[model samples]
Structures are given as C-alpha cells and as structure tokens.
Target: MINLFRSYNPLNILWLAVLVIALRIGYIIGAPDKLEFVFVESFARLLVPVSYEYALTPFLNVLLAGALVFAQALLLNKLVNQFNLLGKPSFLPALMYVTISALFTPFLILSAPLICNFLVIWMLYKLFSLYKGDDIKSSGYDLGMIVAIGSLIYLPFIYMFLAVWIALIIFRPFNWREWIAVILGYATIFFFLAVLYYLNDRFHTFYKIWLPLGTQFPNHISINNYTYVLLAPVVFILVLSVFKLQQGFFKSYVHIRKAFQLLLIMFIIAGLSFYVKRQFQLNHFLLCVVPVAITFAYYFLYTTSKWFYESLYLLLLAGIIYFQFNTF
Candidate 1:
C-alpha cells in the first residue's frame, strides 16, 4: 500500500490541489457584488445562480473543466513519461503543473484578453505533447485540433498555429498530411460555429464575435505579486533547471526535450496573446502556468543545489507579499 501510494504521489500534489481550489474559493468568497465570476466564471454562473450550490449547478461548467484538468493531467503524465522515456517524474512536477494551471482558472473567459491568453497556452501544450511521436500526420492533426479548438475559444488563438508550424519545421520536419489535419480540424470548428452563427442570425456577424474585443486599458496586475506567491519558488528553479539540463546530454525521460518545447510553445503563446491585444489580465495568461509549473516542479525538486532552492523560496515569499498587498 505504501508503495502504491508512493507510486501515486511524490511532493505536494494534494496540498497543491487544495490550494488551487482555495484560490478559486477565495475569489468566490471575496468577490465584490458586481464581480460575479470572472468572464468564463460567468459562463458557469449562466447555468446556476450564486445562491445555488456551485458544485451542483451553473458552477458545473467550472467543475467540468476541473474534472477535465485531471484528465489533462493524466494525459500530461503520459506525455512526460513517454517524451523523456524517463520513469515517472516526481510528484512536485505534477503539483506545479496542475495547481498553477488552476491558479489561472478564474480567467478563462474573464475577459477578451484572458480568453485569448488561455487559448494560446492550451494550443502550446497540445503542440509540445506531440514531441515524441513519429507519425507526422498524427502530430499535425493534434496541432491542428489545438489550433482549431483554441481558436474557437478565442479567435486570436488561431495565430498560435504560426508557432506550431514553425516548431514543426524546427523540431520535426513537416509532412503534407499534417497540413491536411490542420485544415480539417480548423474546418470542423468553423462548420459548427457557422451553424451556431446562423442559429443566432449572425452568420454575417462573425466579425462581431470573432473580432478581437476592444483592447481595454491595462489594469493593475504586477508580476511581482504572483511571482512571489502563486508562482513562487518554482519559477526560480525552473529557469536554473534549464541551464542545468543544458550542461548535460538530454538524458532523463525527455530525450525529445518535450518539457523545454513546452516552455517555448507556452512562451510563444503568452507573448502572442499579448501582441494580439494588449489589455492583459492576471488570469488571462494562466493556461501557460500549467506547463510552466510542470517544468518548474520537475526541474526544481530535482535540482542539485541548495542555493537555487533558497533563492526560489525567497522569490516566492516576495511574490506572496506582493499578493497579500494587492489582495490578489
């Protein structure tokens, strides 16, 4: 039983999960009257009023996503193991990825910027997850699907396909089949969305919904705040871990450099999300956090230096202070 439990866990996954849920609860509890849920939270609220139990009602959508987060986690677990051909990674990696992803949850459709940002990260993760496969068509299809699905969520996410194509050229040379998958996947979303557009009598109004929301002025979100608490020590260790990994052959489970690829893809996603429209929100870029945390957790927990760990904790504490001050 001990071995089984150990096999299932390593560092702080459960605690992290609790913390993630708590953050959402914090938002719900501390929410100002007009605050309702964030943009996508409103999507859930659409199904049920705040007076009803969030678990059993409109909040079900959020609950569904949370459930999907686990499914996504399972897929990601398989990804790390398969990409690196490394045995199971430590639990810290899982905690970091899942919890950080959750930290960004309040943003999904929080506003246009957040929606765009989350979509970018989702596409990037899907791209990185395909690193180990030999079937170019399959990988291309996956990439295409990510582009389409993410684009459907927020149209600007379609631009993420540029990174996908570039990464394909850089990492795995392209096959025409990949292009076919991308086109097909994209067409699939359009077909359904087209149908919905007609139903809404807005087939001509694609520009209205698909158009970028007017860029809002920058709101008050300091990187220092989240970096200290929500992101914390993991960020410090993650950057150093990359340097450490570079010092040696890409030995471990990720011979294909899946985790590294994940970072690049997510960074590109985050960067592109911002460039697509400037009015960024704290929750918007969260999708990137999942992979960010994962890479950080795996690399940080396994770091060989006390200095790195200490610096990380300190930075996190700084972030916490920032969070407390901002009430973020």
Candidate 2:
C-alpha cells in the first residue's frame, strides 16, 4: 500500500478512497446509536447551518464523515503537490494526510478544525507565494483575513495569527508596515462583525466572542490509555522525520529550508493552541494533522530502506484501526 502511493498516478486516487473507507470501517460498525455533531460557537453556521440532530443512522453519519474527510485529504494532497512541498509529485502526502487524520477516532467525524483546514491550506498558498513576489503588504493582509475567518469557525484558530508573522520572518526581511497590515486585516473582519451586532441591538454580546481566547492552560486532561498506543507510531515517525531533516538541513534549497521552518512553527502553534478551547477535545488536534502529515511525507519519501518504511506505514494503519475498535 505504501509503495502504491509513492508515485503520482491518477488511478491511485481510487485506491486512496478505498483506503479511507477501509480505515473507517471499524468505527462505522461500532458507532453509537445517536452520533452527535456539535459545532460549538461556529460563526460558519451563519453561512451554512449544520444539523446538530443525529437524524441519520450511525453508519450513514460515519459514511458522510468519511466522504468529507476523504475529499479534504484529496484537497490537502493537491495543495502539497501544487506547492511542490514534497520536492516531487507523489501521492504520499495525501496518503499520509488520510492516515494521520484517522489516527484519532474523534478526527473521523466532521469538525471545526477539519473545516478550518481549508483556510490553513489557503494561508499556506499565500505564505509560499511570498518567496516569489515583492508584495508583502497585500499578502500579509490576505493571510490575516484568512486567519480571522478561520477563528470564526474554531476560536482556537485565532492562534494561527502567529503563523502570519512567523511566515513573514521566514520569507521576507523586516518591515513594520507588513506586520501592521496583518493586524489591520484581522481587525477589519471584527469591525464589520461589531457593526452587525450594533445594528441588531446585541452589541453587548460582542465582547463574548473573545472569551475562548482567555481560557487558561489545562492542568489535567483525561485520556484513554489506548490513545497512548495510538501516539507511539506518530512519535516514531516524527522522530524519524526530524533526524531525516537534520541530515539534509543545510543542503536543501533556501526556499525549501524556510518552508520547513514555517511548517514547524505551524505545527507547534496549532498543537499548543488546543488549550485555548475551554473544553479539551481530541478533535481539536485536527489542526496539527496538516503539518504532521507533511512531516510524515518527508520521512516516507526520503527513507531509503523499502522494507523498513513499508513496515512502519503498516504499523501506523494497524495502530489506528486496533485502537479505534479497542477503545470506542
């Protein structure tokens, strides 16, 4: 299965869909009678209202989630390929994305982070374009607005506001104007939102939108023991990816080096920002999956030993399935 996605082939898309369904099969079978779909304080609902009621059967819910995630995986794959982030065209990024997205059962369903991922990809596109363009102000403004929109979907997404500054540091020289542009762009969104509230005589509630940003760092989180087993493979892959990156660190092109640095910042920010949510949920970690998938792709693409890499990939798939059935 790993070898099949090592190259770019149109037919591989079919296999990708198959792999998505195969990974979700266990969860589909064991899903609860009434699967809840919650969109906590999502401003996106104003645009597209999601039905919170579990009117559909568990199987159908899982199926629908699987389909949505599968499509996201494909789009994510296309984004990576479009930017040539993997150094060469291949299906590895998509495969890794789908696999990592399923590592946690909570990630299998439609969630805010999953929706915010589309914005993340859009942000990356604008960030990467910085290397080739001289228009820092416009790009910074666009990225700020993108992050602002994402925050409306998932409040923790506001943390991605840091990535814009980090990307500017990685891709451009010091310029205070560009930095200010980001702030201006972010405020632009809320300025309009505040106006809407004022017109509706609900301006008093406008301040409540920032409440999630004030959540304290968590002291404790109860997680199943099985989740630790699930983390083992991911940790191993990340360790291997770090070592691999170190080996070729200085030798890679300047743009590639900066891109990896930007991705690292994204991963760290996304992971830590989960604390911003008052209630800790596993699905919140979906924000980390995008960069982690790219990191996994780096390891899988560069590792020389076919037998070892393939075995590791299988181990990851097995871990996800086993834990899904064993735990939930």
Give stretches of model 2 more than 4 Å off: 40-57
Model 1: per-residue Cα lDDT over 1-328, one tens digit each: 1122124453444654554454355334434434333332221222233462233333444444454454455455545554442245544444444545544334421343344444544554566655666776765666677676665554555666767776665556667677677777767766776676677666686555544535553454455444445643555456676676565426754435654664666565654464344544555565465556555545554565667565664455344334433564
Model 1 RMSD in angstroms: 6.2
Q: Which numbered prediction scores highest in TM-score against the true structure?
A: 2
Q: What TM-score quantifies how close candidate 1 is to the native fold?
A: 0.66
Clash pairs for candidate 2: none
RMSD, model 2, all Cα superposed?
2.0
Per-residue error at 166 for model 1, in Å?
Answer: 2.9
Against the reference, the lDDT scores of all candidates come to: 0.51, 0.84
